[model samples]
Target: MNRQLTNSKLLLKPASASPALHRVLTVPQLWGIAVGLVISGEYFGWNYGWAVAGTVGFAAATVLVTIFYITFIFSYTELTAAIPDAGGPFAYAYRAFGPMGGFSAGFATLVDFLLAPPAIAAALGAYAHFLNPDLSPQWVGAVAYVVFVSINLLGVRDSANFSLVVTILAVAELLVFMALVAPGFQLKNVVAHTDSFGWSGVFAALPFAIWFYLAIEGVAMVAEEVKDPRRSIPRAYLLSIGTLVVLAIGTMLLCAGAGDWRQLATIDYPLPETLAMVLGKGSVWTSLFASIGLFGLVASFHCNTLGYSRQLYVLARNGYLPAFLGQVNERFRTPHWASIVGGLIGLGALFSGTTDQIIIFSVLGALVMYIVSLLSLFALRRNEPQLERPFRTPFYPVMPAVSLVLALICLLAIVYFNLLLSLLFVGLGAISLGLFWRFGRQRINVHLTTLGEAERH
Candidate 1:
């Protein structure tokens, strides 16, 4: 029965009474979504070393690292313009490699989304300690998860607005920190190095650096939601990436100027610590500002949860999984159930292990998704040469090829430093492939039989 359904093209037709699936999200809203992914405490802890190293290791290399993110955004913009659909990686994979490949891409992306929220929530909880030293980390994490999920369940517009407000505040807080501390900038502090930069240190730091830039592609996930997605997505993508790069670099400089490199590296939440040092322990204003920035980091996870759930819904609708997940909430016009399911998975992560462990797994999953996306782009171009594309990736073959190579290097670095996390990802992929083959074959058979019945009639 499922096989017939899978093969049946009749179900693919749009329903007359069915409202348009695509929602017209504004440019700022789209930008908020991208920012939600990029602006986080996780970036602060993990990528500080990489950004500093990139800046000082080799001047030209730092520039390349900065440009790498911009280049990636442009490439993804082309993909979004070509296929402004909800399935995201799933849709791209489907068009490029067929059903099995699509299922794997979609499944892997779902894993990445499911793991991200809890990790972010935990990070928020950890940072919250800087404010209230006595609060329990688990309680903080749980409260954050509930609050963020509640906002998303309310509606996409509400969530987007919340994200925008938080991002604005977060950016403001960072700017304020920089403004107050920039005067203290010392060249001697900027060049201070505790550890030597070699192939091993660079490789060790690769996973951490990739984690910082991991979610830039998140803009592509919401392609269908944006108004004039073709233009809006690209603009939002480039703008958000640029903003994040500047914010990251400036923050690095502020930290360097505020204290020694070793001291900055040792502290977990460097920004707040730096603020506390410069303003003194009794400064309530700086503390409040730092709290707002932490709130923004929490909001970023909320945005990620929504984006991932919607992509899962699109995948389910395409016969890659259970059909029930595709149902949209009539009142909210959001995927309420899928969002809940995603939240549960995140909550489970909180119970499953330590925050550091989750971070490692999340980083590994993101790298795999990036590699697949890069390859999918190339495959689609070769397979569908005549397909209409509103935005074309310049230097097509070469650009994507370069992305692929960089992704591989990042992946290798992950495997080298974190074999256990790498193995878990591989295991998850294998399970997803097995499920897809079993379920997809059933769908295909049902679809074929339905076609035969129609012929007989």
Candidate 2:
């Protein structure tokens, strides 16, 4: 058994089970799933940047962030195709750098996936409250968590189908917003409102700019469930990002142009407010936009739960967490336990009622994951030159190098802008990893031993 482990074949071995995570997602469903995980950002969270850097500053930050993501996503798809693990970057790092590296990468993935849903939930709750002033935002969000987790628990096909429906509504909502505000869009509005937040302000806005495309990579977490991953994954990834870039730019320009930039700057439902300016404050169109806009938040909250559970499921299956977390519902074939727990955590964070702080911490985790995954790309290329790669990142070292440098810059800027919060994030992550290294190490060895025996038979 030990001799067989020498060649790293054991690393790819699955625990004794029928193939897990049903492959019900098709190319179109995957595209919707990918877009759904991120569309909410363009609708709400990115507006927060205006408060920090104004329209022009945030737009500059966004353009740079878009470049970072384009390069990063293109590079990242290569890893997804080659590895195609539900663990995503964790699996990539594990195959490249061993346990400790895997833990760090997995931890970062956990942080982002776990933290992001709460922010979206908060937005969901806010949108619900906007439509009906009597409803409690917190309760609305908590209900959404329960309902979506229930949906997710049913099965992957059901979840993906739900995602496709809501994702279409979300995209349609954006188009409606664009049409209503298109005639109102004036370049002078952005020009007149642009503030000199300086380079510092631009840096400060990086996290919010990131909100525009955050979690788009989450599609890779469902790699095990794709019909033809090697082809479908790359197509879904490229299309999703391309769609997001167009929506983001259109949304930003129209929103900034339609009203006082400050009006939407700190709001949860930026589009409705921008629409209010064009269509009258208390108009039916404004109310309709507000009601339908929840789909975007719902889309992200629902799909990100899918990503989170899969990441948690893979980690536990690999012995980085309690083995029970990896358990699938036999009837449903879904990661029911992980989904429930992740949703509960998001509910807890939503109770804090601080969206920006939650977002910053989440972005911090994403930044770390991005850097680690890119490193894994280079490490695997150098160490396992013969490993079959279905698709190679177009520019090789240059693309990843660009991604790394941009991600590092964003990380530094985030740290600089939110020193204490960054410190708290790093401290919590270090403590979690330290505990895992001390206690979880034995579990990994035992699991591997069992796996090796199972493979021998």
Candidate 3:
């Protein structure tokens, strides 16, 4: 009773004292941010699926994954427009299932956002190594972490501008790559190169296929900072996903058509290598490909680091993590502490070294969030029908229902192929939830109750 009374007193704290985030991003900046966050997927990682499933099999898996993402993004827009919080999926899950659900969604989002950069950083390292062959890829990745994180810490506008520049260059590089490879694209290459794995290979390829469109949902994380979220968030989400889908399909086709899909499947820097095959090794085009290709990886590495920091900030703000991780820098007006901590974690993960491993593990976390979030959509519709929604998902329940089912199918396929990673993901999630239940609940309960009281007062 004494503890409850004390909690009530804490819950009565004034709303004016709460820390606030800056609102500075617009729709175009959000396009840059969203595309930049996932464009690296188009450049690398997805090719690895060819090794597992062959070109046709990988393409099949990609088609399926694309459906899931399209539906998922359309449905996700409603949530973002309705509740524009940096917490993204966590914000939706929290409203539908309360504190425990929020932590789970937030934790899984952390896993997705945090693990992705090291993989992209490793790709950046590989690109650097391609140019000089002397600089260690690991060290190059470490340097990238330092440089991009510093840019992000400087300010959100600076970070968004940097992302815009890199994203354009990255897109331009892909266009150049497609043009160079267009002459060499023979229909026979894809048919002749089909691996023995066949249909089963499609299932094995599911996680890698996801690389084509992964992390695009990250746009929602910045809804809090958007100038007009209801209008802007939905536009950004649809446009970015549409752009990515066209690019993913075109890139995959051109890549397989240009050379033996078998050889392209295993390399870290597939684009330069594909260019080398078509334009000749050591040619100026290959070198240009190597140089400009870094921008694609850089764009993703930089933007995702930004996403991870905001996620950490959201977690801390909700009292699911340490309060210090939630602090916005008065000088830069960014989440300085959260960015630094997330960078340190990404830097430490550089030692993992395997891009595919990091990517598969990261997808597992996203899969969990996808499941919970789709359920949240259902829960919210039933539980809070009166809630104001500026943008409604077209097709109502069908879009989310299809997205949820496809997500589950993809998750199962990925797990079937990656048993060890799936087990590790489950173990980590379980342990984290156990710890949160034991201790973090008190803080979250107090925080939520306090917000409610403040609103009442």
**Index of the highest-TM-score prediction:** 2
Ranking by lDDT: 2, 3, 1
The parts of candidate 2 lying over 4 Å away from their true place are: 1-19, 453-457
Count of clashes, each model = 12, 0, 0
Compare the candidates by lDDT and give the number of the best one.
Answer: 2
Residue 291 Cα positional deviation in candidate 3, in Å, after optimal superposition: 0.5
lDDT of 1 by residue, 249-310 (tens): 77766666665555555444667767666776678856765677685576578778877777
In candidate 3, list every pair of residues with a backbone clash: none
Give the residue spans of candidate 3 off by over 4 A. Answer: 1-19, 452-457
lDDT tens digits, residue span 89-134, model 3: 9888877777767888998999999999999999898889989989
In candidate 1, position 325 carries an lDDT of 68
Ordered list by TM-score, greatest first: 2, 3, 1
Candidate 2 has which clashing residue pairs, if any?
none
Question: lDDT of all the models against the reference?
Answer: 0.68, 0.88, 0.85
For 45-78, candidate 2 gives per-residue lDDT tens digits of: 8989989898889999999999999999999999
Instruction: TM-score winner between 1 and 3, please give it.
Output: 3
Give TM per candidate: 0.88, 0.96, 0.95
